[model samples]
Target: MASPQYRLVYWPGIPGRGEHIRLVFEETSTPYTDTATTSDGLDRVLAYVQGNVPDDNINPPPLAPPILQHLADPNNDTNVTTISQTSNILLYLATHLPPGSIAPDPKTDPNALFYLNSLALTALDGLSNEPHDCHHPIASGLYYEDQKPESLRKADNYVRVRLPKFLGYFERVLGSGASGGGKWLYGGKFSFADLVLFQCLDGVKFMFPKAVSKYEREGTYAKVFALYQAVSERPKITEYLKSSRRQKYSDGIYRYYEELDIEP
Candidate 1:
C-alpha cells in the first residue's frame, strides 16, 4: 500500500507562520503539496477558514491558514486528518514523518518531544508574535499606518529590551548542557525547535537588521547567532534559501517599517 501524502494549506504570497512548517518539510525532504503554489491554493486555504470545507473530523473549524491535512488519497477524504496552528502541525509532522527527519523518537526519550515543543513555542511567542506586534501595537484590526505612533513606541522597547531578552534566553539554553551539549536544541539532534528558532531569528534579522547585526557583532548572543549560521549552511536549507520556494519577508509576521526601526 502507498503511503499517505501530506498537504499544507496556507496563504499564497507571504511565508508567515507557514514558513516554519515549510522549513521542516524542506529540511526533512518530506513530500507534501503546498496549496499556496497551486492553481486554486488560496481558495482551498479559505475553504477551511471559512468553514466551507465540510469534514466531520474538524470541530469548530480553523480560524486561519497554515492548516495541515493528512490524506490517504489526495482525491478522497475518507481517511483525512486536518489540523491547524503552526506549532501543532509541526509537532504532528515531527512524529509522523520518517524517523530522524526532524525530531527524536518519543519511544526512547519520552520528554523529548514535549521539551522541543516548549522550545518552539517560546521562540514563536517571544520572537515571531512579539516582533509582529511591534508594527501593529495598537490592534491587529488596525493598519500599521493607523497605529504608527504606538508602533514606534512598541518597537523601541522590543528592540532594546525584548529582543535581547529572548536572544539571551536561547543562548543560555544552548549553553545549558541540557540540550545534550550540542548545537541541536534538544537531545543533541536536529529537531523542529531548531528550525523554529532559526526562522524566528531570520525574520527578526530581516525586520531589525541594525539591531540584530549589532548584537551579532558584539557577540552578546554568540551561540544564538551561531545556531542561525549553522542552520543556514545546512545542505538542504542552503538550497532552499536560494530557491524560489523561499519567500521574502514583507507585511507578514515580521514587517520592516523605517519609522518603527530603532537600534537597541
Candidate 2:
C-alpha cells in the first residue's frame, strides 16, 4: 500500500499562493491532488478545518490557499497535514526534493541561496503590502474606490521606489553568479530562490509593465528575466504551465488593475 497521497487546499479560483506549491510539485514530478476547484473541494478543505478531517492525526493550519497535506500515512485514514503561508510551503517542499534538488542544503552554507530566498520573500512581503494599500489604503476593511486617493499615493511610491529596489537586488544576484557567468539568480544550480524571484518578477511586470520595462533594461537585471524565460521553457514546466494549473494574471499577488497603472 502506498501513502495516502498529498493534497493541496486552496481557493479554486486564481493560482495565487497555491500555484507556487503546484509548480514545485510539477517540476519535481511529484503526485498530489488539488482539493479546491469546486464546492466539493471547498467542503473538503472546510471539513478539515472543522477537525472533521479523514486522518485524525493530520493537523490544520490557521490560514488557507496554500496548505499541503501529507497523505502517505499507512493509517489509511483521512487525517490531513495542512500548512499555510507560501514561503513555508515552498521551504517544506524544498527539503522533500532529493536534497539539493530544489534548494541548496543548509550544510553547503549556501549563502547565495539563503540570501536569494530572503530577498525573494522580502519582495513578496512588500508586494502584499502594496495590494492591501491599493484596496484599503487607509484601513483594511475600506473599499479601493473609497481610498482611491490614498491608494494612488501608496502605489506611486511603490512604483517609483519600492518596486525598483526589489527588482534591482535580484538583478544583481543573477549577475553575480560566476559559474554560468550570468544565468539563474544563484547561478549553476536552479534553487528555489530563482522560482520565487521569477514569480515576483512576473507579478510586477504584469501589474506594471512600463515600470518593469524601465528597470529590466537597466542591464543588471537582464539575467534574472532571462532565467525566468529559461525556467518556463523546461519540458515538464512547459507542460504544467500550459495546463489549467498555471494561474492567470487576473488572479494572485500580481493583479492587474488598469486604473492603478498611472504614468507620468
Best-performing candidate as measured by TM-score:
1
Backbone N/Cα/C clashes per model = 0, 8
lDDT per residue as tens, model 2, 153-243:
8777888877767666666766664434666656477866666666666666777777777766666567667888888887878898788
User: lDDT of each structure?
Assistant: 0.87, 0.68
Q: Candidate 2: misplaced stretches above 4 Å?
A: 1-4, 44-60, 106-116, 127-132, 177-180, 218-220
- Cα deviation at 248, candidate 1, in Å, is 1.1
Candidate 1 lDDT, 98-173, residue by residue in tens: 8677887877878888899999999999999999999888899899889888888898999999999999999889
Model 2: what TM-score? 0.82
Runs in model 1 deviating more than 4 A are: 1-4, 57-60
| C-alpha RMSD in Å of predicted model 1 compared with the true structure | 1.8
- Candidate 1 lDDT score at position 182: 55
Name the candidate that leads on lDDT. Answer: 1
